[model samples]
Target: MLKAMSGKMCSSSSILQAQKLVDQLQIEACMERFKISLTAADLVRYCQGHRRSDPLITGISSSSNPFKDKKTCVLL
Candidate 1:
């Protein structure tokens, strides 16, 4: 799906046409899902790093993640 869209985006003659292709592809939703998942992973890493020296907080961040294969999430 993205590969086809990429070709269309590249072949687009004008900025407006490219923008229209992006809109038709719903790229914003894909981008937002990617952002949320990446942010969640980063947050987990940060908390684990900070908690290492501060024993007051204890938790584990798993290297194995179920969402690794997930491509999209529900948009809020």
Candidate 2:
């Protein structure tokens, strides 16, 4: 299965199809941990300029001051 789904040989559409099959097989819970691994890999690729934007990266970058405290918190 991995051979047929090799990254070098498969397009995004094929990968999506494979993911759907995996979902139907009810192994998504096992695959859940891989979501972070895949996101990290994509983030590394994005930082290296090998790929384009990801929502996770974009949301972090676009925030003006994510760490800022609220005015109410300051008065407390």
Candidate 3:
């Protein structure tokens, strides 16, 4: 995606394209690669404590993960 956007002028069209690329790359297709499971309480806790984390105080857990998956998993 970055390759497609490289050397392009920073116009409104380019900015919108860049945003779309981010949504598709970093936001949509990140979790299937990791096979991680997350829950609602996890999201609430993260949002509640996001500002509280400092360099030394920040903690990350691979088990009982409290982070939201990047992909949108809609059940339709």
* Candidate number achieving the greatest lDDT relative to the actual structure: 2
* Candidate 3 lDDT (Cα, 0 to 1): 0.64
lDDT of 1 by residue, 31-65 (tens): 54557888999999998878766634643334444
**Each prediction's RMSD to truth:** 16.6, 16.9, 19.0
- In model 1, which regions exceed 4 Å deviation? 1-34, 55-76
13 Cα displacement, candidate 2 (Å): 0.2
Task: For candidate 2, write residues 1-76 as lDDT tens digits.
Answer: 4344444766677788978998877875655565878899988877778335544555544345667554544454
lDDT leaderboard ranking:
2, 1, 3
Model 2 lowest lDDT segment of ten: 50-59
Best-fitting candidate, scored by TM-score? 3
- Model 2 residue 64 CA deviation (Å) reads 72
**What C-alpha lDDT values do all the predictions have?**
0.64, 0.65, 0.64
The TM-score-based order of candidates, best leading, equals 3, 1, 2
Residue-level lDDT tens digits of model 3 in 22-48: 888886676555323556677767767
Lowest-lDDT window of 10 residues in candidate 1?
A: 1-10
RMSD of 3: 19.0
Model 1 scores a TM of 0.27
